[model samples]
Target: MSILIDGLLAILAIYLALQSLLAPRLSQSVFLFFAFGLALALAWVRLGAVDVAITEAAIAAGFLGVLFLDALRDFSSTISEKHNNTEAIQSSASRKKIKTFLLPRLAFGVGLGLFLLISLEAIWQIPQGGGLTAAAESMLPESGVEHPVTAVLLNFRAYDTWLEIGVILLGLLAIFVTGGIKIYTKPDVVAKDPLLRQVILFFTPVLFLFGAFLLYIGKSGPGGAFQAAVLWGAIGILLHLGGKPVFAMIPRWVGQLVLIMGLGFFLLMGFVFMSGGATLFEYPKAYAGTLILIVETLAAISIAAALTAIYANLNQMKEEPKENESAN
Candidate 1:
């Protein structure tokens, strides 16, 4: 039964992934990608990595799905505004020509086949039952957290985790550079439905409570900072959709501070530990668990803020004026 279930999940994941890439319409591809993400999450669960499954579902299916839909909307509007029917038809014909080109398709198929064979060979070469499992298990007692995943992430390899948080901030910075630091001065044009408002009211507190619960439970289970961050970020998105932009209501400096709080605190703690003759991010055994909890808490908050800011910026992005409009 387990084997059959795993086989079905594997097939579904592969099918969705291929379809997402090859779909005829952009909207179709985006929706297919969401399905692929969900399928992948199920595969992860079957592999007993519940934490990874949760992160994959939340970030890939939830956050990225929204981002892709927003991009699609902008892309479609721009295409409609900039190109007439004749140009659109010509472009479509050119794409069809490229798609039907025999030589290019043949070469791509050959290359992909070779790549798949190489990947299979590499996977087969990997020695089974030969990883750091034993070592990690032995060191788990001293790593400060009951959950091995949490221990490895927040204690055994904390520097890597710290860098991961920094990377998220850097991504946000890159988005800001591209979009020129858009601060939302007003709420987005959301639907003025009473049910939408009611939904937001109902989920706001629930999401907060759930996010905090996940953060606290990470010490012993398959919940952690990243998972909690996604939930908290969802709250910001909900508020934005409900015509109450949280970041817009707050001071710019305050928003910036929140964005940097996680990475800054992480580095400060690392340096403080280094000053006491310990290696950077190497917490003393006596205070390791407490310190990890504090770091995770701050990292969650910072990550949530960064994600919300990203969504807000992307949502508020205006299409550039066309040449005729600009001339006028």
Candidate 2:
């Protein structure tokens, strides 16, 4: 029964992935991509990596899904404008160009096929039932967390986790640089549906409570900082869609502090520990659990802020006017 379920999930995942890539319409592809993420999340759960599954479902299906849908809306509008200008030229040339790169397309397809075969071969060659499970289990008692995944992420591999947080901050920085630091401006038109308002009210508190619950639960279960951050970040997104724009209401300095608190505190702790003749991020066994909890809490807040900022910036972006429109 378990094997059959796994097989079904595997097939669904593969089908969704292929359809998402090959779908002719942007909206169809985006929806298919969401399906693929959910399928992949289920696969992760079946593999017993619930932490990974949660993160995958939240970030991929939830966050990235919203981003992709927004992008699709923006892209569709831009394409519509361009199509009006180039429809005649494109209509005449589209069919002629269809077969122009036949050989190159065939070669690219063949290359992809070979790559897939090579990847499968490599997977099959990997040794099974040989990993760091035994070692991790042995060290679990001293790692300051009962959950092995939490232990590995917060203690055993603290450096990598720290860098992961840094990467998220850097991604937000990149977005700011490219998009010119869009502060959340209130939309000219806000949705005033009572049902939508009710839904937002219901979910807002639920997400906040769940995010905090997940952060605390990470010490013993599948929940953690990243999962909690996604939930918290989602609250901001929900509010934005509901016309609240919570991030925009906050003072700029406060926003900056919240955004940096996680990474900054993490580095400060690392340096403090290093002063005690220990390496960076190597917490003393006596205070490890407390330190990990603090770091996780702060990291969750910072991550949530960064994610909300990214979404707000993307959501508020205005389409640049075309030359003809500008002249008019």
For every model shown, the clashing-pair count is: 0, 0
RMSD vs true structure, all candidates: 3.9, 3.6
Cα deviation of 292, candidate 2, in Å: 0.9
Candidate 1: what lDDT?
0.86
Residues 186-217, candidate 1: write the lDDT tens digits: 66455388777888899999999999999999
The CA lDDT at 200 in model 1 is: 86
**Cα error, candidate 1, residue 225 (Å):** 0.5
Best by lDDT: 2
Candidate 2 has what TM-score?
0.90
- For each candidate, the alpha-carbon lDDT, in order, equals 0.86, 0.87
Off by over 4 Å in 2: 77-100, 188-191, 319-328
